[model samples]
Target chain A: AQSVTQPDIHITVSEGASLELRCNYSYGATPYLFWYVQSPGQGLQLLLKYFSGDTLVQGIKGFEAEFKRSQSSFNLRKPSVHWSDAAEYFCAGVRGTSYGKLTFGQGTILTVHP
Target chain B: DAGITQSPRHKVTETGTPVTLRCHQTENHRYMYWYRQDPGHGLRLIHYSYGVKDTDKGEVSDGYSVSRSKTEDFLLTLESATSSQTSVYFCAISESGQNSGYTFGSGTRLTVV
Candidate 1:
């Protein structure tokens, strides 16, 4: 069974401040990792994904994630956050065999303040 | 956006009544999934369809059933609504592959009284 763990339940940051959201996964093999964002009353949107190459994967809205195989972690990072970036973030992992089913972690709610 | 839409954006129902939620997609993706989102639990998959008339149970599929008779539609049915079932449901679509990113619908909020 694959599981994703997000340590932070909520985080607050000022506008233009750096942000990092931690995520850890437990899977037997090399897993496919992804980050998704959801606003209130909206569906989730994919931020980025990590398949194999490039430990650091860049995503939309100036978001990026680093897949650290050693630590079993994929942490999302942004140099500067905007107020509009306030949303819920989820980390998910998929085994190589499963077609589309994703195991998602408890999301981290991000609050961006001016 | 993958053209996925969930019907009855908001629904209020009584317990013991049957409720069916519809998920329609214009992208014609091969994979469709039903998930429920609750406070603190994030999103948990209830069911998924790989193709027309082919479906599978997900992690939290005990009280739910699903059907996919066409390529563009997947329906999730709760035989008997329970107060525990009140939550936001989301529909997602993905292409036929392992690495494809999922596209999700806005979501349907169902409240059972």
Candidate 2:
């Protein structure tokens, strides 16, 4: 079955510390990947996406994700975390052979500690 | 943010009642989608419309229905609401197919009591 998995259900880090959220996918081949952030009581906002080309993709709010084909991982990373970044993070992917529908992983809830 | 809008930012209805959620877009996108967000399950696609009248079922489309009669509006109807249908609903739009990306609306929080 094709699916995306986020191993960490919840993560906590100091406000100024580094942050990394893991995402792995099960697919026949390379798939289109994306990272989205959802603030409380708000809709999701696209943090970044990886279609093709470079592995390291930059997105808004100083967030970046690297797509590693060997590991089947597309982990989201931030050099320094902010308190405002505390929210639910989801990783989604689309199979190359399918339509525009998406398969999303169980989201990771980030908590920023002071 | 301003391109897509969802009606009744929040709604509560009794079980077995008919409920309808509306998604309106001004971007003139060709594809529209409805998804339900639940705890521990992320977001599941309920239904999607490729064109005005073209619609298809998604992974969890068992108890939901959708209609797209015009280019800018998509409606999701719950013929008979159930307790399991209480979830946050989000509507997204794409300029074209092939999963280029999606722009989502603010989302509607629906509760069935």
Candidate 3:
């Protein structure tokens, strides 16, 4: 079974500051990873997904993540954070015949301050 | 953006009552899923349907049941609502294959009293 772990429960960053949210996964083979963002009382919006190739994947809202197979981590990063970026972010993975059933992490709440 | 719709944006039901949540999709996705979200838990899958009349249990499928009569409609039922089932339920749709990430519905907030 594939599982995801997000070390940070909450992250606070100043506007225009670079931010990074760490995510680690445990899968037997190459995994399909994704990042999703959810605002207050809203559905999840996909940020980006990684299937294969291009370790560095860019996503919507100027966010990007790097897939490090050695460490089994795919960390989300943004060079400049906006106040509107405050939301809950989730990291999920599907691996080893997991058709579309995603194993999601506990989630990380992001707070952007000016 | 995947043309998914979840009915009853907010619902309040009494304990021991039966509640059904509907998920309708226009995207014609082959896979549909039901998940519940709580404070500490991110999203726990309740059930999933791969095709019409074909369903399977998820990690948290003890008190919940699901049915799919058509490709576009998936229904989730709580046989007897409980306080533990009071949470936000989200419906998601996805196509078959890799990298085709799941598209989520707005969610339905169900409160059991």
Residue B6 of model 1 has an lDDT of 90
Tens digits of lDDT, candidate 2, A1-114: 789999999999999999999999998988999999999999999999999999999999999999999999999999999999999999999887666788899999999999
lDDT value, residue B77 of candidate 2:
97
**TM-score per candidate:** 0.98, 0.98, 0.98
Q: Which ranges of candidate 3 are over 4 A from the true structure?
A: none
Cand. 1 TM to true fold: 0.98
Q: Give the alpha-carbon lDDT of every model.
A: 0.93, 0.94, 0.93
Best by DockQ: 1
TM-score for chain B in model 2 = 0.97
In candidate 2 the C-alpha lDDT for residue B7 amounts to 94
Model 2: DockQ vs. true structure: 0.70
Residue-wise C-alpha lDDT for candidate 1, range A9-64, written one tens digit per residue: 99999999999999999999989999999998888989999999899999999999
Q: Could you tell me the lDDT of residue A23 within candidate 2?
A: 100
Interface RMSD of 2: 1.3
- Candidate 3 per-residue lDDT, tens place, A1-114, comes to 679999999999999999999999999998999999999989999999999999999999999999999999999999999999999999999884765898889999999999
Measured against the native two-chain assembly using Cα atoms, what DockQ does each of the candidate structures obtain, in the order listed? 0.79, 0.70, 0.69
Candidate 1 Cα errors over 4 Å, as ranges: none
Q: Per-residue lDDT of B22-67 in model 2, one digit per residue for the tens?
A: 9999999999999999989999999999998999999899889999
